[model samples]
Target: MIARFDYIAAVILFSIGLYALVVKPNLIKKLIGLNIIETSVYLFLIASGDVRLGIYTNQWAASNVIDNPQRAVQGLEPMINPIPSALVLTAIVVSVCVTAIALSVVVKLYQHYGTLDAREIASLKG
Candidate 1:
């Protein structure tokens, strides 16, 4: 049940991001969509790696959060995994670099054409 719910949410997020990416006409809007897509994938990664038990989310507040040993809740029996987290960290940096480069290109394009809309940019292109 938990798995199903998480997957459903992930799918929804990805779908919305995709829609935004495809349906938007402005370059900045498209960039925002790309960011949305990136964030959705990251969220999906973390959720997909969440520990579970018998259809239950086993995640709990750590002692660091509550600061009460007696009332502290144990972490998920199996800590989902760590590889995804590491990969996501790398992906985040890469995405940031990509976005920066893209923005630079877009700025140059705007300077040459003075428009941010994809349709307008295409018309201005020669």
Candidate 2:
């Protein structure tokens, strides 16, 4: 059986991030934790969809991979699915946008309350 240590590492990273997000009182720390969780998800996706060359042969010889386009669709063990990698790319872009928006919100919150603590901010509101 193949070892799934990568998955374990990703899970660990995700757990750490989750702990930080839940335990940290500072908004910045929560944001950092969110990013860490995102990193872990990326790692998981990449690890799950890992593709090693030469393991799976196409209908044609390995040498023809570059030359014959048809060989790509007709493979022996099947080529690695590109969907996960593509999804990861989209996720990365979305994550960056989310982080940027979140940081901007954090800045505004800090400016309004002069503090970065979530508890303090909440108390200040009411």
Candidate 3:
């Protein structure tokens, strides 16, 4: 039986991140929530590669992969599909951009209101 601890942990972390995003009124804390969610997303993506899609083939991957099959004879891609990996890389870069922008906005908001709390932000002078 394949232990799905990674899946369970990722789900739990995602829930925490979602809760933090919803319950936190501080802009910085919300950004932290965003980071948590991003981390969960990356974890999920990595996990997908490891999950068995179950359509095994015997085509050869690289020579080394051919040399070291967990099984024998039949060919397979050996390496999980790289599509998710590439997408995850893109997602990471986009998440970084989002974080940078969020931080910039927080700084501006702080300058304007001298506070980082969501409710306090609206209380500041225009």
| TM-scores of all candidate predictions against the true structure | 0.75, 0.78, 0.76
Weakest ten-residue segment in model 2 by summed lDDT: 58-67
- The residue-by-residue lDDT of candidate 1 on 1-126, one tens digit each, is 544786677678788878888988888778888887898788778776765544433354321333443442365234557788888999999999989998999899888888888888777745
lDDT of 2 by residue, 1-126 (tens): 236777888999999999999999999999999999999999999888876555455532345444555766677333567888999999999999999999999999888889998888877763
Instruction: Indicate the residue-level lDDT of 69 in model 3.
Output: 64
Backbone clashes in model 3, listed as residue pairs? 57-75, 58-74, 58-75, 59-75
Query: Which residue ranges in model 1 land beyond 4 Å of their true spot?
Result: 53-77
In order, the Cα lDDT scores of the candidates are 0.74, 0.84, 0.78
Model 2, residue pairs in steric clash = none
Top model by lDDT, which number?
2
Q: How many residue pairs in model 2 have overlapping backbones?
A: 0
Candidate 3 local distance difference test against the native: 0.78
Q: Pick by TM-score: which candidate is best? A: 2
Greater lDDT among 1 and 3 belongs to 3
Error of 1 at 73 (Å): 17
Candidate 3, residues 1-126: lDDT per residue as tens digits? 246777787898999999999899998998999899999989988888763434343333223444456543354425566788999999999999999998998999888788899977766668
